[model samples]
Target: MKSALKISGYCLIRKNRVVLDGRVLFETGPMDFSSFAAEAYLHFNTCYPKFHKMDNLSKLGFLASDILIRDKKITESFKGREIAIMLMNSSSSLDTDKTYQQTITDRNNYFPSPAVFVYTLPNVVIGEICIRHKIYGEGNFFITEKFDAILLDHIVNHLFNDGLALCCIAGWTEVNGENYESALFLIEESSGTGSGIANFGPAETESIYQGI
Candidate 1:
């Protein structure tokens, strides 16, 4: 059985769509998180992920890390903040896997691109997020046949209480060729707002995904 999670802010995104349904107001991407970043800056109280294609693990890590900061005013908000990233997917960087194989197979592969090679693993996203955000905290990756909201909720709840991440960017970044869907949330502990958990109930997951 998964333990309960504590979440404050919940921001969801899907297919370049940024859904602001909670206290935090932000954006995600239009092939990049630039617009999302811009919105966050304006709001001064939200979190958004970084933008990068390939829908790979590293990118997901980078995305989550970008949002876990406390003091948006601080030069280094991620500093001293623990981050627990819970990710879901189907292919699990299979795109990178095939690409790497192609790179190695080419006899004339003069430049063995280490950059591409690094994103082959599922956990690379976790590593990238931690490194970029300077988050020295707990991280976990889950590769399932499809998106499971229950699993995400369970993991996030535990991490919050354990003090792993003051907030989390948890969701599914599934890539299928050029067509992909990303439903992510910036989950955090409460600060004077109502318990975000109350937002949960039957069809709650779908509602969050819908951004309504």
Candidate 2:
């Protein structure tokens, strides 16, 4: 039987708040990005201590994925290798890159921390999510001027057709200074479970993204 793609779950985070599948999970008054992220981490009960040490980009991805996968039960049913991740953002870790650059900009006070420097790459956020969820499948990160749901849908469909993954965590995650947003979806082959929304094509994906 041919596999039918479906959207099993989704999460959106923005403006110091998190919403999972149309339900508000966490919300806080005005606060810095770092503080807001920390509050979300604590509210989600994520015991990952390293979350505090990660750069803003990684923290955003980690927190968003943590809520989506855990609340949606993606990891419990799908093996680590069966799941893939494809994330995109406009900033492309420029937030962390600028921070890292500041450290070395002053030669006399130069003190580049490996922890901060390591997250300079946008793909590092994918690595952090994979490590947290033990997902060893294929993953990619793209930098685009804005969210491209059609491009994301095509890439994820290719992964499924090529037998590279059975499920995918795909979406846009962007963080720059006080501005941050993420809209992640869990796409999987329909097994007649009757629990997921059917027809996960480019238009459908774009609609969902736009609705968020």
Candidate 3:
């Protein structure tokens, strides 16, 4: 059994910037979320074409997870059932829901779009990440009023303690239209089999996120 849960890597997407493990990799100077996401996607050279069609929420989580999965190369060390993803946010897909509501709100123009309808749930972001990375371990999306580091810490530990997961992609992802912020961390064992994998918990996670 692993002795401790460690944070392998972290990525924060906020203020039109992308910070991966304390380094600024990409920044869209003074642009809106839509434009910033497009530029960041292209800048990172991510080949996921479906990225163009994702709602703002999915886009935020995708690009942030992309840094850890593609940039930090976590998938190279952990894959399939060994990797899990757990995330929480306050908005709970309300941003996309508002847009979907518009499709059916007006009597004359009540035309619902299946494409827009698909992203009405907050879990869509997790599904997008899981499908893209092929991670089959426990994936959960929680709705919280604020950043609950204690809650995130407990859930992640439970996955590891119960031997249900080896590595977990965890954090907070909240998106409300043009206003969005996400902090994702890759959690692993502190003194386990991996090298250069830094050491875990709510305080550490909170500090890493707060610094960004």
Candidate 4:
């Protein structure tokens, strides 16, 4: 048996509220995705100016990541290359795609700005997190019809078994229009730490994502 895997920490974001380790850290009334995201940015004191420039999808993912990875200082415990990130979503940046399309639908009003153009891809959120935390390990983003906790379980295990990663951040993040949901978990081996919050496996992971 390759030592136990543990779910050290996790964060969930939904309906303009952010939850960390089962506690609601921030919650707000009805608001647009941009307004909620900006409010979250300020509330958390992220201090990253680039956050304001990111599209809705990136902002959502970045916020969840910052709460789990940066705020918790998970990356500080492992080497950059020893950490990995795996994220899955349903919309796959469609929210930003729609916005991009709006800027070019009119022949005369079409505008191509790199600022908005760069966030067209879903993995950009992964890029932003990696850049912020200096995580150089393997990172992969997948698009599924819905959250597939089993698939994520297998991938995370494979990375650890093959020595591709010592610690990992994996979960589901999806943003469509004003709706968004994310549940990111920080997984680590059980040698040094006491069992963590719980073991990292399909059942545990799926349960958390399901409940979230």
Every candidate's lDDT? 0.56, 0.87, 0.88, 0.87
lDDT of 3 by residue, 23-118 (tens): 898887798899999999889898899999999999999999988888667778876889889999998999999999999999999899999999
The lDDT leader among the candidates is 3
| Candidate 4 C-alpha error for residue 107, in Å | 1.3
lDDT string for model 4 (1-119, tens) is 46579998899999878988888899999998888989999999999998888888888889998988865677667888998999999989898888888888899987876787788
Q: For candidate 2, which ten residues in a row score worst on lDDT?
A: 190-199
> Stretches of candidate 1 above 4 Å error?
1-7, 22-57, 60-81, 108-111, 161-165, 190-203, 210-212
Residue 23 alpha-carbon offset, candidate 3, angstroms = 0.6
lDDT of 2 by residue, 1-212 (tens): 24678888888898887887777888999999999988888888999999988988899988889888887777788899999999999989889999999989998998997988899999998999999999999999999999898798789888888899988999999998889989888888876355685477778778777773
lDDT of 3 at 131: 86
The worst-scoring run of ten residues by lDDT in candidate 3 lies at 190-199
- Candidate 2 vs candidate 4, TM-score winner: 4
TM per candidate: 0.66, 0.95, 0.95, 0.95
In order, what is each prediction's RMSD in angstroms? 5.6, 1.6, 1.6, 1.3
The per-residue C-alpha lDDT of model 1 at residue 2 equals 35
